[model samples]
Target: MDVADLAALETGGSLWTWHRGLRDGTAVVFDLDGVLSDAASRQHHLKGPRPDWEAFFAASGDDPLINEVATVLHLLAPELIVVLLTARPARVRTATLGWLDRHQLRWDLLVMRKDGDRRPARHFKQEAVRGVRERGMDVALCFEDDLRNVEMFRSEGIPTLYVHSGYYD
Candidate 1:
């Protein structure tokens, strides 16, 4: 089907537009960290220096899926506005942006948590998704690897495609 037809499929709907342009004017939101890279797994394996956290960001060098996913996004929906919603600190904003650029990924928005909030990460992510949805662009889908975040997105009526990380495999 065409982009317009896909966009009108449902209110806050998600359809596989991997080979189709975005419906007339809809945005696609993606979760960074776990979904794009094996951040969570790296973090889990590297306990020496906060394994999970370090591995999440440090494993950027050898990540295999970054280019693959980027290529898919580039080919499937080049016109769709892409956003990266993450709980990473705002301090890493420059680094994150650099990573995306280096990987040749296209994204429209990068939402990060503020400096001093201790709330649960999932809550912060939910708020970010809500903010994106309120901006007049329907959130077509969210690519995520965290179950809690997935649940949060679903609770907010956002459809999620869970990346099958090696943790479960």
Candidate 2:
């Protein structure tokens, strides 16, 4: 599929592109919220009824970097295609970019959920992984905090390392 088709398939709504073009090779995927950016402070907003997603994401810019994860990302970026895949919606792209810049985390590609698309994280990320693979890249490994996502990726034959961020508990 072409870029347009890939974008739509990945996002499920309007197209969103980053500065980098698709790279074909071994790719290591990382989940943003819990894995890279420590969203523990803002995860409270997701509790209770009517999960205030806006508030949770709006405060994303202030999320501190997961030092160890950031280090791993930096170490692997120069050698492998680092793909930052997040369940966070795409509307906060600017905030996400700023957060990454502030933390100095580098990634070859960042995939986010489309606005208005509220599928569970596992499903969305699974599709994102497929999209990445379809672009001729092999998803060799993934680092994710969500157990559901970890299971999904492993089920798809991708090796995954699960990090416990305490958000799912």
Top candidate on TM-score is: 2
Off by over 4 Å in 1: 1-24, 44-65, 166-169
The global Cα lDDT (0 to 1) of model 2 is: 0.80
Per-residue C-alpha lDDT of model 1 across residues 10-101, encoded as one tens digit per residue = 11211122212332357777777657654643655645544454445545555444555566567656667776677776656556656765
Which residue runs does candidate 2 get wrong by more than 4 Å?
1-16
Cα lDDT for residue 163, model 2? 91
Clashing pairs for predicted structure model 2, backbone only? none
lDDT per residue as tens, model 2, 1-169 = 1233232234443233443555679989889889988899998899997899999999999988899988887777476888888878888977887777667667767788888887788888878788888878899999999899999999999999999999988
lDDT of 1: 0.61
